[model samples]
Target: GAPVTTALDMSQTQALTRAAAVGSAQARAGGDVVPSAPFLIASHGLLGWYWPVSGKLSVLHSGQGIYYGIVPEGDAGGDNAHMPKSLWVVSRPHNVGSNADAKTARRNFLLKVDASPTEDVHVSEGREELAAVPIASVFTHDAYGYANEVLVADTARGDVLRYALDALDGAASGGGRLPEDDEVKDAHVAMHLFTRKDHINTLLAGDSHALALLHSGGPSRAVLFDKECAAQASA
Candidate 1:
C-alpha cells in the first residue's frame, strides 16, 4: 500500500507540495514567512515576543487577542479611527521561577545548618507510622491556610495528617517522640483519617474540601470532607 499524504492548504491556481518530512509539513502550512522565535498567547490574551539571542520574551501588547498586523502611525487615515493608536511594550520579563527556587534553596540550607538530628528522626518516625498503611503515594496541601501548615496525605490508609511548619521547634527542643496520631490534632488543624472499605487510589484537595478516590472495581466513589468540619472534629 502507498503511504497516504495529506494536503494542508488549497490554492486557486496550483497546489503547493512538499516532501512531508520532519518540520517540512509545518513550514508548508505556515507559508513563506517562518516565525524564528516563539510567540506565546498568555491566559489573558497578550502578544509576546521571544528573543533567542537574549533568551528573553516580552509582551508587546496588553490586548485581549492576537495582534494581526500593526500599521504605521502616519498611515492611519480617518477610516482607521477604530484601530489601536498606541501599544504597551514590555522591556523586561520577570523571572519568577528563578526567584522562587532561590528562596526555597536558602530555607533548606538553613535547616541543614542547624544540624538537628531530631528533625530527621521525626520524618523517619512519621514514615514508619504509615509503614503498614500501604500508601501508593504521598502529597502535601495547604489545608490550614498558613505558610507553614500542611496536610500530608497517606493514600494507603486514606489519612491526611496535619504538619505544623513549627514542628522544627520540637526537634530543636531536645530528644522526644514527635507528635503522632491524636496528639497532633488541634481545633483548626489536624489529621482526617477516613474509614472506608475500599482502597484509596488518589487524593484531591479543593479550597474548602478534600476528595478521596476509592479503588472499587465498579464505579469509584469520591468522598468529600469539609476542611473546616474535619479540622474541628479532630480538634
Candidate 2:
C-alpha cells in the first residue's frame, strides 16, 4: 500500500521547494545581488561564537586563535555590568609547530570594542600584541569590573603565565597598538609551571583564585591555585 503524507510532510516539502527556488534565483542573480534575509556581519574565520554585550552581539575572528575572554566595562555590581569593554584573544599562528620560539612568536592580542548603549557596536582596529603562545586565557577583574590581570595557560610549556593589563596598555601609548617586534619585551608578572608530564588544557579565574584543568594519559585533574602563592613563587 502507498504511504499517506501528513500535514507536516507537506509543509516540509513546501519548505524544500521554496529553498530550492531561492537558491536558483540566487544563482541566476550572479551570487552578488541576492535576497537580503540573513545579513553577513563578518567574513573572517570565526573562532568563538557571538557573545552578547549590552543588547548587541559581538564576534571575534579566528585570526585571534580559538580562545578569547571578554572584559567588562564597568563594575561587576554596577548598572553597566552588562556592557563589555574589550576582548583578550589568544593569537597563535595557524599550524604553528610546537618547537616554534615562544619568546619571539607573535601571539596574543587585545582588541577594544565599543559597547555604549546609544551607539552601534564597533570593534576598534587598535590591537596590542604579545609574544607568548598560550592555549587558554582568563581575565580577573576588580570590584569595578575592570580587568586588572590576565592568566594564560601554556599547554605546550606546561606553565601558567600572568600579565598586568595596565602594563600592556601602557606599552601601547600613542594609538593603543603595540609596536611590531619592539626591543622591549612584554614581561609576565608571574608564572608557575604546573606539571611537565600533564599539560594544562583550560584556565578559569575567580575573585582571588584560579583553576587549571590538566590533561594526562591515565586521568585528568583540576588544580586550584592561590593568587598569593603564585605571586610569592614568582618573587
Candidate 3:
C-alpha cells in the first residue's frame, strides 16, 4: 500500500517538536553512546559536539565559548561515521586558575572546574542537548584565552571536547567565572591536554554540579535531582 502525503501549515512549523532521541536513566548511563536526543535545555546553552576518531570536543563560536565537551567514548564517536551533533550544552567551571608553571596552573583550573557548597556557588547539572553536530554553548566564555590542539571526550554526549587556552585567570577559586566582558582577552594560553579520562580519573572529575555536591557544607550541602529527561542512570 502507498502512504499518504500531506503538507504542514505555518503553525505546524512554528510548533515545538518533541525530541526524537531517547531519555531514561538506563539510557543515559547504560547506553554508553548518545544515539538520540534526550535531555536538552536550550535556555541553558554553551555547546559543542564529539568526534569519535580523535575523541575531542569542538566549538563553533570563538572567544566567549569555554568548557568544551564532556561526552565519553564508547558512547560518542563509536559509530565511526564521525559526524558532529546539531547542538550541545556547555558548562563553566565553578572557578578558574593560572600559575607560572604547570603545577599552579592545574590548581587554578580545578578550582573553577570543581564545585563546593562552602563557596556558596551552586552547581548546574548539565542535562541538555541538540542531538546534532556543531553544538554551541550559550553562556560559556573564554576568560583565560583559548587552548591549542587540546583534546577531551564528553562521555555524556559520546563526543570529545576541544579548545585553545591562551592564558589563565589569577585565582583558581573563581576561575571558571567569566569576566563581565562576554569575551576572552589576553588569555596567554600554552599547549596542554585535558581529557574526560583525566577528569574522571582525578579527584576533580565528574560534572561541575557533581563537584558542587562533593564540596557542599551542612545546609549548603549538594544534592542530586531529576533532570526530567530521564536518561541519567544515577537518576
TM-score of each: 0.29, 0.53, 0.19
Q: Pick the candidate with the highest lDDT.
A: 2
What lDDT score belongs to each candidate, Candidate 1 first? Answer: 0.33, 0.46, 0.26
Stretches > 4 Å off in candidate 3: 1-59, 68-83, 91-213, 217-235
lDDT minimum window of 10 residues, candidate 2? 137-146
lDDT of 3 at 36: 44
For candidate 3, write residues 75-126 as lDDT tens digits. Answer: 1243423332322223433334221232222211111121101112222333
- Candidate 1: clashing pairs of residues: none
Candidate 2 lDDT, 13-81, residue by residue in tens: 477579999988866686545432222132233322232333333343434533334443333234445
* Model 3, position 103: C-alpha lDDT score: 24
The CA lDDT at 62 in model 1 is: 38
Return the lDDT, model 1, position 101.
32
Q: What tens-digit string does per-residue lDDT give for candidate 1 at 1-235?
A: 2212122223411221333353676665776454543433222334444444445544443332212221111122354343323221111122222223321221110010111112112221111110011111121111221334334443333445544435533342443333223222232243444532344544445576655556545666655566666666665
Top candidate on TM-score is: 2
Model 2 regions lying over 4 Å from their true place? 1-44, 47-64, 74-81, 95-99, 103-106, 115-147, 183-187
Supply the global lDDT for candidate 1: 0.33
Please say which candidate is ahead in lDDT: 1 or 2. Answer: 2
